[model samples]
Target: MKKINLYITLKQGVLDPQGKAVQESLHTLGYTAVKQARVGKYMELIVEDDANVEQQIEEMCTKLLANPVIEDYTYIVEEGIVQ
Candidate 1:
């Protein structure tokens, strides 16, 4: 089995209103040191180890897991991480 960790985030130049809101709230709470804040999605997936697994994962990200035009996604596949 393989353990997959997926991270999804907004593409550069895209508006991140949620992140901006967090930053503004932090600043209000006197967290002046924070220059920016980003909110992202993290997903953990367990899949059978097979030759087509990598391709399947790529398709999953591009087709459904993330928005290809506005959001970018990256994933890490680890061996022996799932039981």
Candidate 2:
């Protein structure tokens, strides 16, 4: 088995309204040190270990998990980790 930890985030110039809202709220609550905030998605998947798994996962990310036009992603694969 294998473990996939994927992180998805907006492109550098993309607007992040959710993150902006969170930052504004934080500042209201006296957390004024934050200069900027960005929201992102994190996903974990466990799949059968195989030679094609990484490619399959990349396909999934591009097709459904992330928006290629505005988002970028990275993943880490772990071996022998089922716990």
Quick one: best TM-score, which candidate? 2
Instruction: Give per-residue CA lDDT, model 1, range 1-83, as digits (tens).
Output: 89999999999999999999999999999999999998989999998888888899899998899999999998899988648
Worst 10 residues of 2 by lDDT: 74-83
Off by over 4 Å in 1: none
* TM-score of model 2 vs. true structure: 0.95
lDDT of 2 at 75: 98
Models 1 onward score TM values of 0.93, 0.95
- RMSD of model 1, in Å? 1.0
Cα RMSD (Å) per model?
1.0, 0.9
lDDT of candidate model 1 versus the reference? 0.92
Per lDDT, the best of the predicted structures is: 2
